[model samples]
Target chain A: MNEAEIIQKLQQGNEQAFRHLVENYQKRVVNTCYGLVQNTEDAEDIAQDVFVEVFRSIGSFRADAKLSTWLYRIAVNRSLNHIRDNKKRKWFQSFEDAVKEKKAGLLHYATENPGTELENLQRANILHEAISSLPENQRTAFTLNKYEELSYKEIAEIMDVSVASVESLIHRAKT
Target chain B: MNCNTLHTKMIFFLEGELPEREMEEIKIHLESCTDCAAFAEEMKKTLAVLETDKTPQLNPFFYTRVKARLEKQAEEKVVTQRIPVFARILQPAIFSVLLLAGIYTGIKIGQPAKINSDQSVYTENEMIPYLNEMEAEAIENFLME
Candidate 1:
């Protein structure tokens, strides 16, 4: 079915249409969140929230942009919010405990060089921390460009900014 | 280009985003500048680390979990909507009871003080009764005149 039909069905509370949306955009939303948050479980949780919000507030959607664009916007916003919330919540924990919690949240990836797995994980954490340190817009633009492999134009559309602004954001993020 | 300009352009240069002329210029600069070359290499490695971090495969039952959450939310919303209706009925009754209690407390608290003050006034008037009586008689006479 077309976007309009799905939107109408969702507004009417159709289970099948809702399933279709979740099935189609779940990976993109999850991965987009994972790119920003750099944690599998948190990304999936945030993605579920994104879908839940979309379903609950489908009436507010104007369809001025593609549903996927709207979904990406929500995913980015929710992921950033999750990060902010985590920072506040983590403030109460001891440093050692926070470090342990971070390490535990990281998953093991299969590496081409087997012994380099730990090294790679450390590097990944370092890179994730570096990206996380960036300001919100730069981080979002950089993550969208690097992690999601979105073109500059696409990132601009999702961020509701000019392409030049996105280019500047990514450039600043790298520097 | 200067090293500062090169640092800004380093990622774009590595990504092949610069124009051909600018790319050549940056290449020449990188070839000659040891500091710029090292910085570019480090930046390149950092960007490459992004590839090692694989996107995790989402759980198979993600939709199922979302559906459960939505169901819970819907149930909560139903409960929430129903609450206000009952509250609408109960609220005024509770408010009225509180209102009556407040007024009763105020009257109870003030009644003794009010009676004492009124008794003091009566006593003071009794103490000066003859003066008040003469003043009243004088006014009556003046009116009659």
Candidate 2:
């Protein structure tokens, strides 16, 4: 079904429609959450919460924007909130934890190529650190634009910011 | 066309944000200016490296787990909805049945019968002593005051 139809079914409290929505966007949500939270376990948890919130709020969803855009907004907000709450609990963990938690993770490169392992690990560590170190809004804009392949216009809507602001934030992030 | 203007536009040009008409001016400047060209090249390399870095893929079980959780939530919602319907239909019937059983048990217990007139009179008179005790206590306190 098209988004309108799917949304209609969702509003009617159709479980299958909700399922379809979840199936279609779950990967994007998980990936985006993973990017923000940097921890798979926490990302997964936050992603689940995002869907639950979406379903609960779908009745009020106006189709002024694309469904994906709306879903991305929900995912981004939830991820940010998850990070903020975790910070309050003094449980903040770095993106490196995510890389380390990967099965075979950074170690796979080390074991496969003993020569460049140190260099590879160092580069990956630097990149992850840089990404994590970015201010929240800039990091979010950059991630949504780069990793999620969202257009600047779509991101602006998701972030509720001007397209110009998104561009400038992304530019600053790149530099 | 000057170094400062070219430097400022480099990022926008690289991102393809500049208008088509402006592209030629930028291109002309880049051909004559090695410094600007090098800066653009460096920016391109940095952006390229950033783009080429792969985000980690979620585990294979990721979708499976999500689907499971959604299905579970959906099932729970359905169950929750049905609960009220069941209660609405069954509650009054259960209450009526319990009420009837209570009344039946009460009736099954025989009523008290009068055994003797004198015994009933004595029972009635027993409450007056307690009442008199309370009255006497109240009057004594009043008189003492």
Candidate 3:
């Protein structure tokens, strides 16, 4: 069925529609969440939360925006929340322990970002750390632009900001 | 064009959004400007690294896991939606009972304590402090008189 048909069935509380929704969106949602959280397990958890939230609130969706954009908003929000929650947990670590932890994580780089070259994975990690330190809006804009390959216009729509603002955000992020 | 103009358009050039003339101009500019060339190269490297930085694919049973969670959640929603009569009524019942207890206590405390304040009972935590203050006030007034 088309998206409209699927949405109608979903609104009607059809289990099949729900299953179809999950099947259709599970990967993209997980990937988007993973892009923000940088942890596979946490991304999966957030993906689950996003789908559940979409399912519960599908009735309220006004169709004013594309479904995927709405889903992106949810995925990004959940991933950011997970990062913020874990922030405090990692706040008390000693510098040596943190370095050791970084080395340990680097040891598992292949699993951390699958499909990355072994040599380039360290560079990727550094870039990810830089991106992580960006303010939330910049990070979101950059991730959506680079990872999802979204246009600045689409990202502006997702973020409820102007296109010029998205351009500025991405420019600042890149700099 | 100047370096700032070239830098501003670098992202668009890389994205292939710039027109042929502008792209050619930037390419010609990049050839002569070592700084812009290095910046472009760095941007390309960053893009390459980020290109491979995709989220790792989950195991094949990902759909199964999601479906299971949905089913479990659906079951939970149903269970919670049912809202047993006792459970539904019990919350407000408990709240009202506590509220009534508070009001009763307040009234009892504020009442003219016949066994205590006799008539000028003030609403204080304990009767002793109010009685002491009232007695002191009376003594002061008498001394003033």
Top candidate (DockQ): 1
What local lDDT does model 2 show for residue B13?
89
- Per-prediction backbone clash count: 0, 0, 0
Instruction: Point out the higher-scoring one by TM-score: 1 or 3.
Output: 1
Model 2 DockQ (Cα-based): 0.09
Which of the numbered candidates is closest to the native, going by highest TM-score? Answer: 1
- The Cα error of candidate 3 at residue B59, in Å, is 3.7
Please, what are the lDDT tens digits per residue for candidate 2 over residues A1-175? 9999999999998878987888788778887886787665677788888888787789889999888988888888888988788666555556676445544445653443356445455565466567778899998998887778888998899899999999889888765
Query: Model 1, A87-137: lDDT tens per residue?
Result: 898998899999788756554333322465565666666788888899999
lDDT of 2 by residue, B1-145 (tens): 6988877778678988789988889999889989888888765665554443434444566546656776788899898888786797799899999999999888877667559989888998786534577566887889888
lDDT tens digits, residue span B12-126, model 1: 8999988999999999998999999998887787777777554566689999999999999989989878877678789999999999999999989887544688878888878
Q: Candidate 1 chain A — worst ten consecutive residues by lDDT sum?
A: A105-114
Sorted on TM-score, best first, the list reads 1, 3, 2
lDDT of model 3, residue B17:
71
Clashing pairs in 2: none
Evaluate every candidate with DockQ and list the scores. 0.34, 0.09, 0.26
The model with the greater TM-score, 1 or 2, is: 1
> Model 2, residue B60: what's the lDDT?
61
Query: Which segments of model 1 are wrong by more than 4 Å?
Result: A107-116, B1-8, B25-42, B52-54, B82-145
Model 1: lDDT of residue B133:
73
Residue B87 displacement in candidate 2 (angstroms):
19
Between candidates 1 and 3, the one scoring higher on lDDT is: 1
